[model samples]
Target: MTDLSARDIERANFAFSVYDFDGSGTVDAIYLGDLLRALNLNPTLAIVEKMGGTKKKNEKKLKIEDFLPIYSQVKKEKEVGSYEDFLECLKLYDKAEDGKMLSAELSHTLLSLGERLTDEECESILKECLDPEDEDGFVPYAPFLKRLIAGPPEEKPAEAK
Candidate 1:
């Protein structure tokens, strides 16, 4: 936790709301895959194999702990931390003001991380994350961020702007 700031911890906690697959308040295997792939990691079958088969082959959830490895890697490579650093990283993935990102947003976010995704893959990702309402198809940011960092289910997280 030495590398993590209070804000970084908060950001990671907020990220868990959507990333947590089992609603267990703990990230598991599937969640790791999603976050890794979303961040543009190769996400090979071997990685899935390491999960003790608790996760399906194609599942997309992850244990929050799994993220520590990647975070460590990123920190080593890019020296990651700082409230501004966390904000910039999150902003790359958050497309709309509401702070929630569907699959498309995630794909674009990965792109910003230097990954390339096909249009078909992007479409598939959107299909996965989108709420299926809003003909214009925009994800709301505030509630999305709230889901990540909202205090005690009744309070708002501090506004990012």
Candidate 2:
């Protein structure tokens, strides 16, 4: 197994804490879906279907594990979230002025993780996060934090034959 320094583990735990709504320790698909929903992305069966392959009539629900490939890909594409990085992200996404985030806010926050986002992209992201269904089109901070810290699954050890 890869050896992670204590700081790395702490950072990971902090990240997890930021999103783990129920305090389950790990962030799973349901939580992710909630996060997406809060962000106004509302990832549905359609989106999950697109993630894996052709959409099927009776497709198996994609769990957090299902996102492993995407997570790995995202980790590769983007740098890991650090303590300061997470704090900065909190500041950016705190649209409600409550020191937290709405799921919709995360789209831009995530985009900003690697590169600067254009005005058009930022506007599009806002559109996605603020649900039209809501009278104000804004999400509260408490719920947002719950979904953000949902951590990745348990680390696996190297194969031993």
Candidate 3:
């Protein structure tokens, strides 16, 4: 808490408030994981449980004060996926080691494997991250992975007319 910048604290507080749906100054323990993710901390289920997220709703609750420490701790401890990590995973699909793969295969994997993204979700990612496929239908994956890892571009505020 002491080391977090004012803006970081403010962002955490705002995220906490959004999840504190009842205005009760507390959030259900089950939502702890969601709150952590909302703050852009990718805590695993074990980490969430260690931080007091209960499997059952209302079994426990977290006040903003309590959440701040947990958020700080997880933020410090969690290592987000790096570009190399993602590339290595994608490499399994790129048998030729050509740094490119079939765009359709990538979309199929996204929709069918691991976390199993919904059609809309997969489409949204493809729309944003994919480049124009070549004649043979292959696409370079490094740029796509880079954009995906970087997340959506930040929206600029509209100029006052």
Candidate 4:
């Protein structure tokens, strides 16, 4: 596999801790589903069934090396959450007073907001926002935008004084 970033490594370690709920140094299928649900992700239906799937019933525990698939699913759901939040923020960029976030306006707003994207990058984002189904200059930020930027950062509580 490719090298994992520091942040990704941190996330993986934390996920391992969360999965190893019993302090048993390993995670079984039961713990795996629990971990997924705790993070607001639905567990794999096969695991939810617990006694199904092609794999032998005795081979239920998964090693850290086997965590890549679960971690990938977690990342996907986390990104979906970010995209949902970003769409809500896009409401602030409605310049035409018609509630539509136009491609030109979105491109300008993103740049003005210190997105630091190149012209080509911005155009690429605009293209993703506007597909064949959309009319020229008509882009639905709510329906799309997630295709451009991943979801928002995970929120943390403020430290008490």
Report per-prediction Cα RMSD to one decimal.
Answer: 12.2, 15.4, 2.9, 13.9
The regions of model 4 sitting more than 4 angstroms off are: 1-81, 95-99, 132-136, 149-161
Provide the lowest-lDDT 10-residue window in model 1.
144-153
Better by TM-score, candidate 2 or 1: 1
- lDDT of candidate 3 vs native? 0.87
Model 3: per-residue Cα lDDT at residue 89: 82
TM-score of each: 0.33, 0.26, 0.77, 0.36
Ranking of models by lDDT = 3, 4, 1, 2
Best by lDDT: 3
Estimate the TM-score for candidate 1.
0.33
Candidates in order have lDDT scores of 0.50, 0.46, 0.87, 0.58
Give one clash count per candidate, in the order shown.
Answer: 18, 12, 0, 3
Evaluate residue 33 in candidate 1 and report its C-alpha lDDT on the 0 to 100 scale. 49
lDDT of 4 at 66: 64
Error of 4 at 71 (Å): 13
- Model 3 is weakest, by summed lDDT over 10 consecutive residues, at 77-86
Question: lDDT (0-100) at residue 3 of candidate 2?
Answer: 42
User: Mind giving the per-residue lDDT tens digits that candidate 3 earns over 52-122?
Assistant: 99999889989888988898888887455678987988898887899899999999989986657899999
How does residue 63 of candidate 2 score in lDDT? 35
